[model samples]
Structure formats: C-alpha cells, structure tokens
Target: MNQNVQQAAAPGLGIEVSSKVPMHWYNLNADFPEPMPPALDPATDEPVRPADLEPLFAKSLIAQEFSSERYIEIPQPVREVYSLWRPSPLRRAVRLERALGTGARIYYKYEGVSPCGSHKPNSSVPQAYFNKIEGIERLTTETGAGQWGASLAFACALFGMGSETWQVRSSYEQKPYRRLQMGVYGSQCHPSPSELTESGRRLRGQFPDTTGSLGMAISEAVEVAAKDPRTHYALGSVLNHVMIHQSVIGLELLDQLEEAGEEQADVVFACAGGGSNAAGMMFPLLGQNLRGGSTTRLVAVEPAACPSMTEGEYRYDFGDVAGMTPKLMMYTLGADFVPPAIHAGGLRYHGMSPMVSHAVHLGLIDPIAVDQERSFEAGVAFARTEGIIPAPESTHAIAGALDHVTSGAARPGEVVVIGVSGSGVLDLAAYDGRF
Candidate 1:
C-alpha cells in the first residue's frame, strides 16, 4: 500500500480483529520499586544511595500533570501535529514465523513512522504542549543517538519554538546522518564538551579528545535550561511523564491485537536505553498483569557495553550529560566511565531509567544484556525475515526475542510482541559492516 493510503487506513479500518478474552485494565500507580543497597562512589568513595535521588525525582515532569483546558481537550494544533505521524501500527511477523518455524506467533509495534523515526515524539509532542502552555520559548536537551534530538526539534517546530541540542561526541562524529536529520528539523546540534558550558570546558581540559558521554551532554543542556528562564529541558527517555506519553504505543497495540483476534501476549520485549520505549510497551502489559493475567514475561534488553541493569550498581548519581547536574538515585555504571563506541549509540548510557530500574530490582521485570555482534546478527535476521530494518539499539530486543524463540521456551500458539522502537534507515553504515 502507498504511504498516504496506509496512513489513512491506520486508525479504524486497516484491520478489524477481536480479542480472544475479555480483559480489564487499571491506571499505573505512582509507587515503584524500592531502592537497592547503596554503593560507594568510585571517585570520592562516598556512599551512594536512594536518599540522594530526592531532588532529581522531585523535578521529574512525569511527577506532575497538565491542568490546562487544551491539555484535557487535545487541541487541533496538537492533533494536527500528531496526525502527521501518530497512531503507529502493530504488525505481525508472518515471515519471521516461517523462518523460525516455531509454533509461536510474532508481532511488532512499529514506531519508525514518526518524524523523528522513533517513539521519542510520543513524549516530545506532549512535552512541547505543556511547555508552550507554560510560555516556554525554547527547549534544550542532550542527544546520544540523535533520535531524541530530532524528536524534540520536530516538536519545537510544531510549536514554533527554537531548540538546541548537545549530541554525544561519538554519535556526532559517527552518525552524520543523524546530526543532519536534527539540523533538518531546525535544531542546532553541537558535540558535547564543545566549550559550550563550564562542564564541557573542564572536561575538554581534562581530555582533549574526549567523546562526550550522556552525563556530560546532560550537564550542558541543564546549564542552558537553568541559566535561561525561558528555556526548558526536554528529555527523550526516563522520567515518568515520558513513559506515560509513550503509553499510546501500548494502548494502540491493545486495539490492534483486538483487531487481529488475539488475546494476551505470551511475552513482550523492548530495547532499554533510558527505558521510555520499553516501559511504554510493557506498562500496559503490566496493567494486564495487575488484572490477573497469567504471568506474561516482560523482557528488557540492553547493550553489554553499558549494562546498567545487569552489571551496574544501584546508587545515587548525577543525571546530567556530564557529572555536573543534580544527582538521582538509579542503577549506574559510573558517570566517568566511557563505554566502548557501539553501533547502538543510544544504548551506551551509564544508567537505567529510575522507574525501569526500580521494576527490575523488585523482580517485577527481567533484563538481559547482549553484545554488539549478536545484536547486529538479530537485526539482520529481522530485516531479512520481517522486511523491516530496526535501529541498532532496538535490535537488542530483537536479539532477545530470537533467543527466546530459538530456545523453544515459547510453545506453539503462544504470542510474542517486540517493540521495534525505530527504523534503521539512518544506520545503513552499521548494517553495511555487518552484512
């Protein structure tokens, strides 16, 4: 089908299926997993604990709700912007099923159709809406893979607001297409530690060839946002509000599953960076769990190079792009530890989302970290079978899905849903190397 025709058919008429079982759901609770035991900071050798997260958690955008008529009404402007790419589709992987030759059914909710080509816009649009309503003039943020930067830029454009982005140095250098994409959306992109802020300057002095980390980029963005009263920082992932905004994915998936005549998924999988996309996909599933569905396995996949959930310590750490910002209690690898340059740049973070980390710690969810080569292998397999090239970061989830299927863990007639958070069109170079 043509793009326009497909877009037109997305919401109501594209497919009509029914749910196998009647299931009721509930709203997400504000309460989350308790903090793990504190770890000592390597730099200062001080105890890092959940108590240190008080200030950062207090500032989370998700912690608050919009109180405007437009927020409640969903204005035309907002609808117009969303209609451009809202309501992404949930697709079943028939070809993948043939390839696996397993009795299991595979499905994926595609979020690559967004202007930013990822699920980031789910939050970006709402974030822009609230900020514009609050009379904010500009937005600032850090970008590791450029998906978040592009999403913010697109959202700001919808609101006629300017945006500034500090891209991680490795991503800025390695993914020119991503940087260009951000620029195309009218956001200025600078490599972090570019003498832009005090943090960057100090870091540059320490290591002249430093490739900026998310921690550093966050520091620069926070500096800009805090210094300018008119500007607000927009984060692509983590935080409750961002995850809540992304619930549209799961919400839509529920409707799509009904259309396909499927019931509860046997397993759900999504890539975990800062955890917005994963949480978006799984939270609704968790809601299903709350309603007493049989244990639906929820899996979070991360990069082994930056395995915050699997290998890192849960402790209080700064959430900035640099180590300069206020601390948040989270599972972190270490702010100063630079991860190896991996194709999944977005997954190279040193920390996990507080909510996601909390969930994992409480044993409410499970996490696994995969190496780059294996992830790329899964990406290739998915592209060949499903005819969709997934982002390197998201390929981790695909990798996990493949492992689950190949292990014969899922029986025939069981279902699996993978969140293909973004397309890998901009990542052709990475694929070229793998193929």
Candidate 2:
C-alpha cells in the first residue's frame, strides 16, 4: 500500500470520497513500446541533456522527465499539501443524463473542490515542493486561463516561495479576478506579450495588436526563467512530468468506478488543451486497456477554434513560438499560429501533448472538435441539470458527450465519464452575455 494513501474516505464538503489519493504517481513511459523522442537543442541540434536544462529546471524535475519508472513516489511534503483536496468526488451525473434524455449513465470527476479550482494544483504543489528543496527561490511560468497561474501561486505561498506568471492577453483582459487571485496568493502576474522579455518583444514586433496564445506566453516566461539563475521555469502542461503529476485524478477514478459498481466506462471524455487534463484522466485507463484488460473507449474533446488534435500536422515542432524549448513530435497547428480569442482560453494552444498525440497517432483514443456555441449550450444544460457551472474549457467535454446522445450513438445503460476540469465562478463575465 502507498504510505500516503488514504484507505478511508477523506471527509469534508459533505461529499463522498470513495478512494484514496495514491502516494505514487503513475508514469506510462515504462510501458511504452518506444521511448518518447528526445528533445533537441536548436542551437546545437543535439538531444537536450539533463545538464542542458539544469539552468532552466530543477534537477529533480529533469530526472523525472527522463525517468522510465512505472510509479514515482510523491514526496511526503507534497502529499501533505494534497490532503487539502485529494480524492475529489466522482459524481454520477444522474440529473444531466435525465435532462439529455439519454439512457447512458454519465459520471464526472469534479476537480473544482481544490482551492485553485482545477487540476492545475495537482502538479503545482509538487512542482513548488521540488523547486523549494532544490534551493530555487522563485519560479516563472505562463498561463492561458489563469488557472495554472493561480494554482502555482497558491502552492508557492504555502511553500514560502515566489512565482511570476505571464498570462495570455485575452484571458488577462477577460478574467481580471484570476489576476487578483494570484496576487492574493502572493505571486506577481503580468499579461503575456508584455515588454518584459526578449521573446515577448519579438512577438510584439510580429503581432502588435493581436491576442496572445499559450505558445507566445511560454516563450515570454521561458525567457525570464532562463536568464535568472534563481528562477526556473514551471510549465502548466504538455510536459512529461506535468502529466505524471496529474495521474492522481485517474488513480482516484480507478477506485471510484469500483465503488460505483461499474465494470468499466464505455467512453471517458475530457477537453484537450495542451492535453494535461485529458491525459491525466485517461492515462490510467489506457494502461489498463494496454494490459489486455478493460476495453474502455477514451475520447478527447477539443475546441474547433484551435483544433490541434483534429486538424494539426503530426511532426516535430517547437513547444513555444520563440523556439526556445526542445522540439517535440506532436500534432501542431504551427507554433506561430495566433488562435482567435475564444472563451475557452486554455484550449488555445497550437500543439498537443506529445504523449497524447502519440496515443491518437496509435489510434488508442478518438479526438473530436466542438465549436463555441455547442460547448456553451452543453455547459448551460449541465449547470441547469447538475447545478454546477463548468469552466469553458470543460464545456468541450460536455459537448462531446452530448453529441453522442443526440446522434443516437450512445446505447442504453452505457457508462460515460467526463472530466469536469474546473469551476467557472470567476468567469461569470463570459456567462453574463448569455443572461
């Protein structure tokens, strides 16, 4: 048994916590038939060595990046912090199923219970812990919808560290409260494409009046981290370590399904952004499926406005717009592409996670793109039925499940699980237009 795992239900919030949050996070690398591609340094055109990233990331994180372990033990300090909101409830969306008039049973893993209101903190707490123990004083990173920024900020405050975040410009303007929330958690926040870094300056030169994307924001944040010896970059998604840290979501879901008396989900869904949330929820399922057990269908829902999985090319591409990070083989819509300022700010990234892209390439899961209107409609219907307002990023999942029921593809009594990634309480402005 994992030492930090809770066998008994963690009590709070008047909700049933059916499973323990695992002390060891799962890593799929050991099980993969082929190792993930090694990122190459643009300047040297060589496979990026651990020492090459020493200046930009904690050595511990760098080791985890290349590790092929099936499970990495979560530091006790990190697990202590996770006790605040681990084992988030897996709810059967009975009301939603009835509202949709579907015979398929719908379940959701609600991540909004966390203080940062998303699964971002699942990685943030551990990332902050790694940096703190490594003698790093401050962390720098980028955000799209501010969930990642706010999560890291809260974790840093708990660890008595500091963080600087460059949030996407559109989200900065649309979600002012997220910036204020970061400040409350003792982190400084700035709009991306700010004239603070050379990467930001170069982007400004090209698109002086354009909304910023995650790729652009990552470039700005990486520039700052690479320059300061005391500051290291902490990415929100699309990295191996980040995705591994997020396995807690699926680890809990594994037990939840057993408690719910379901054999396996017929289909599991999550909105794909940089792909952390979907990967987090689906990775364990894939592991089970790969082992010749559980034939659960995995699905990724992406925004049509920035459909990296559905319309992008499968090739080696830079993770950022400025070509600072290593080249990853993933589905990309061109790193330089500036996505339209859609309401689902988090889904505006140009490329998918390499692991997720590889999974799609192998035909392990299916990807579908949903437009703004249908996502919002599904979100509204879910709110009315389930009494929980989902984040715009999560609405894509709702829309995906809704599509199957309406199309008469979902059979009666089939089980469907959706990842309700976060709450939209801070995004009332986006909902105001509807009212």
Highest-scoring model, TM-score: 2
Write the residue-wise lDDT of candidate 2 on 1-435 in tens digits: 242223211211233332376778988777666677777788877888888889888888898888899899987677777878888899999988877888999999999999999889999988888888888889999999999999999888777788999999999999999999999988999998989988888788888997999999999889999888999999999988998999899988988999999999889989999999998899988888888779999999999999999999998899999998998889999999889998788899999998888888888879999998889988898899999999999999999988887799899999999999999898877776663
**Best candidate according to lDDT:** 2
Number of clashes recorded per candidate: 11, 0
TM-score list, all predictions: 0.85, 0.94
Give the Å shift of residue 336 in candidate 1. Answer: 1.9
Instruction: Give the C-alpha lDDT of model 2.
Output: 0.88
**Each candidate: what lDDT?**
0.76, 0.88
C-alpha-based local distance difference test score of model 1:
0.76
